[model samples]
Target: MIRVVILGAGNIAQHLYTVFTKSEAIQVVQVYNRSQKALQSFTNVATTTRLKELRDADVYIIAVADDAIASVANKLPFTNRLVVHTSGSASMHVLHKKNRRGVFYPLQTFTKGKEVDFSQIPLCLEAREKTDFKVLQQLADAIGSPSYKISSEQRRALHVSAVFVNNFSNHLYRIAHEICEANNVPFQILHPLIQETAHKITTLTPYMAQTGPAKRGDQKTIDDHLEKLDKDIHKEIYTLLTQSIAKTYGREKL
Candidate 1:
């Protein structure tokens, strides 16, 4: 069995802990956080607020924030064990070399109370050593997650793409919701379109899935949208995206 000690109590930490516990091949020996209060939810497993009291384990998964990763790894009392972080933007080198470093980035946005299917999340794995990479793969396999062997450089590129697809797109949804609220329209009315847009990418490339006034270079419709928007920020975003879509389709004006 692979023993893992998760070192944070945040969203990623909680989700990883939940999935790891449900796997028969992996055992969460202990959970460590800066304070005991956050560790309250991990009742069945051993937990500590102090690093010095950490138990020896096969893997130490540092599921903390990007800035705090090095601090936690540097403070660890042990060395040469497999140490990995659950960050997409941060490089694996962020983990102190005192321990073998790896990355276990799950390419999905995690929320505190949301329960996601572990099998649906892809695990982005990177390690300094080939053996360490295998260990991470084993952990991924235990959770039934599809694993990818991504180098740090490739992982960095992937992370940026993820931001564009996940983060930026989510922000657009927020903007749409705000517009809906201002117009006194039910946001749920747009839910089907949102779901269809997401599903279209499964069979068609985004470039091929394009369909809108901007894609058709309908300047009148574009102007109408800009004029309808009440906020300057929303107008700016609309214009920018319209320009982008037009440019993608080789349309000089929209």
Candidate 2:
């Protein structure tokens, strides 16, 4: 079995732990978190709050916040072992040089209490050594995840793109919900459109899938939207997005 130590109890950590446990080829030997309450769900495995008490394992996966990764890795009491992080943005170099460094970033947004199919999530792997990379790939394979060998630079670029698609897009959804609420309309009305738009990208490039008043350079429709928005911030956002879309479709003058 590929012994693994997960060093966090957050959303990604919990999800990973659950999936790893279901894989016979991978064993989550230990789960460490500074907060005892956070480690409560990981009752079946060995748990510790102290870095000095970490157990020997084939790999140590730091599933903590991006900012806290280096500090945690620097504090690890062991050295010359495979250490990896589950951060999409942070580089593998963030880990202390004391241990073999790698990145095991799963390019998907994880939420507590939400069960996601690990096999469908793309696993971005990076390691300083070839052997360490193989170990990460084996772990990914054990979990039935599609693994990709990516460099730190490529991973950084991918992370920025993720924010645009996932984070920024979610914020737009919230804005739409707010607009619907203000108009006394059900937010669920847009659910089908949202799903259709999401599925369209799977078969068509986003540029080709584009369709909207802005794409058609309908300034009157754009102005109506801006005027209908009650909040200045919402109007500003609408104008900015309209401009972006118009420029994308060669309707920049609109």
Candidate 3:
């Protein structure tokens, strides 16, 4: 079995620990955190507050915040071992040069209490050595996740695109929620449209799936939307997105 020591007790770390423990091909030997309190949730595995006391493992997975990853890696007692971090934007080179470095980024937004299906989540991996890449691929396979060998530059681009698709899209949903609230309409009314939009993208390219006034260059409808928006920020967002959509369809004059 592939032995792993997970460092950090945050959402991603907790989720990885849970999934790894369930896989017969992998074993989470220990979990480390800066404090013992965060380590309490990892009931089945060994836990440690002291980095120097970390046991030897085949791979050390640092699932901490992007900023803290380097600090944790630099403090590790040993060197030249396989070490990987779970970050999309942070380059694998951010890990101190003392160890064999790699990335094991899961391309999905993780929530603390929500369970994620590993099979559907994409695992983006990178390694300095080919053998280390295989190890990460094996770990991804053990967790039933699809794996991709991506360079740091490519991963950074993907991270930015992910922000546009996932984070920005979620914020739009929040804005819709606020609009519904102001109008005294149940936000649930938009649930089917939301689901349909997500479902459409699976079968059709986003450009092909695009619809509505902006795509059609319906200036009257666009103006109506901007005028109806109660907040200036909302109006600005509407105008900017509409202009973007219009530009995408070669209707810049609209």
Candidate 4:
């Protein structure tokens, strides 16, 4: 069995602890945080606020904030054990050199109280040693996740792409919601389009799936959209995205 200790109590940490405990091949020996209050969510397992009190486990998984990862790793009482962090952007080398470092980045947005299917989430793994990489892979498999061996450089690129696809896209949805609210239209009207757009990318490349007035070089429709927008920020965003789409399809003159 792969014994593990999670080193945070945030959304990602809680999700990981829940899934790890469910897997027969893995065991969550303990969970550590800066305080005992957050640790309360982790029931029936060992919990501690002291780094020196950490138990011996096959791996120590740091699921803390990106900035705090190094600080937590530096405080670990022992060295040379497998230490991994669940961060997409932070480099594995950020963990103190006192221990073997690896990354176990789950490439998905996690939210508190929302249950996720671990089988569909991509687990990006990186390590200096092949053996260490294998250990991460085993952990990923135990949780029914597909694991990818990615370098720190490649993981950084993935992180940026994730921001574009997930964060930026969500912000666009928020903008659309605001627009709908301002115009007295039900935001639910856009739900089908949103679902269809997401579903299309499954079988079609985003470039091929692209369809809109901007893609068709319909300047009149694009102009109508900009004119209908009430907020200057909304208009500006519309204009910028229209220009971007036009440029992508080689219709920059539009």
Candidate 5:
């Protein structure tokens, strides 16, 4: 069994602790954070605040913020034991050179206080050495996850694409919410449409599934939508995106 010492007590840490603890092929030997108070959420596992007190383990998984990773890695008591960080945007080189470095970043949006479905999330693995890569892959498989061997360059591309899918998509939902509020319509009415929009991409390419007043070249409808938006900034954004989408479909006027 691969023993893992997780370094962090945040959302990703909690999720990984839960999943890894339940896996038969791996064991969570310890969980460490800078503050002892934050470790209360973990039960039946050794928790510590001092990095010097970290126990021997097959791997030390740093699941902390981007800025704090190096600080934590620098404090590890031993060198050359596998050390990995679970960050999508941060590079693997950020970790201290004292150990076998790798990135075990999970590509997905994490919300505190909400349960995450790890089975649906993709794990991106990167290692400085081949042996470390196999170790990371073994852990991923133990937790019933699909993983991809990605270089720092490909991971950067994935991170940027994720921002467009998760961050930008959430902003669009906020805009939709505001529009619903202005029309005295409950935002719940859009829930089905929003769900369907995401579901459509599973079976159809986004380009082929695109549909709107703009796609149909309905200039009158496009103008009405812009006028209905209460905020000028939102109207501007809507107009720009609509125009861009229309142009892609050879209906530039809309």
Candidate 6:
């Protein structure tokens, strides 16, 4: 069995630990964090607050915040052992040269206290060495997820695109929620539409599925949407994005 060590006790770390421990080909030998209290959920698995106490695992995965990754990686006592981080925005080089560095970024937003389906998440793998790349790919397969090899440059692009799709999309949801509250309409009314919008993209590209008054250059409706916005910033953002979408589809008038 491939012995594994997991760093951090956050949402992503917890999810990965749970999944890795269940894999037959892998065994979570130890879990380390600066605070022992954060490692509470890892019952039956060895836990430590000291880096030196971390055992001789085949691979060490740093699943902490982007800022804390380098600090943890730097403390590893071994050289040439596989070390990987689960960050989408952080570069693979952040890991100390004392160990082989790689990235096992799962391209999905993770929220604490909620369960995530690994099967739906795409694992982006990158390593300077081919052997390390295969190791990451094997790990993704062991966990029953799809894995893609991406360069730091391509990964950066994907990370930025993810911010647009996930972060910006969530903000749009919040805006819709507020609009519903102001109009005394239930937000649940938009649930079906939201699901359908996401479902449509599975079969149709966002460019092909694009719709609305903005795409059609309906100046009347565009003006009405902007006038309905309670906040000036929201109106500005909406207008900018609408204009961008219009330009993308060759509808320059919007």
Give the local distance difference test score of model 1.
0.93
* Superior candidate under lDDT, 1 versus 6: 1
- The reply for model 5, stretches above 4 Å from the true place, is none
RMSD, every candidate, angstroms: 0.9, 0.8, 0.7, 0.8, 1.4, 1.2
What's the count of clashing pairs in each model shown? 0, 0, 0, 0, 0, 0
Candidate that scores best on lDDT: 3
lDDT of 2 by residue, 101-178 (tens): 999999999888989999899999999999999999999999999999998899999999999999999999999998
Better of 2 and 6 by lDDT: 2
Tell me each candidate's TM-score.
0.98, 0.98, 0.99, 0.98, 0.95, 0.96
What is the alpha-carbon RMSD of candidate 2 to the true structure? 0.8
**Model 1 CA deviation exceeding 4 Å by range:** none
**How high is the CA lDDT of each candidate model?**
0.93, 0.94, 0.95, 0.94, 0.91, 0.90
True-structure RMSD for candidate 6? 1.2
In candidate 5, what are the lDDT values of residues 53-129, reduced to their tens digit? 89999889999998999988898889888999998888899999989999999998888788777778889999999
The 10 consecutive residues of candidate 3 with the worst lDDT sum are: 219-228
**Runs of candidate 2 exceeding 4 Å displacement:** none
Better of 3 and 5 by TM-score: 3
**Candidate 6 wrongly placed segments (more than 4 Å):** none
Report the C-alpha lDDT of model 4 over 183-215, residue by residue, as the tens digit.
899999999999999999999999999999999
**Global CA lDDT of candidate 2, please?**
0.94
lDDT of 3 at 170: 97
Can you write out model 1's per-residue Cα lDDT over 1-254, one digit (the tens) per residue? 99999999999999999999899999999999998899999879999999999998989999988899999989999889999998888888988888999999999999999999999999999999899999999999999999999878888899899999999999999999998998899999999999999999999999999999999888888889889999999999899889998899999656
lDDT of 4 at 164: 95
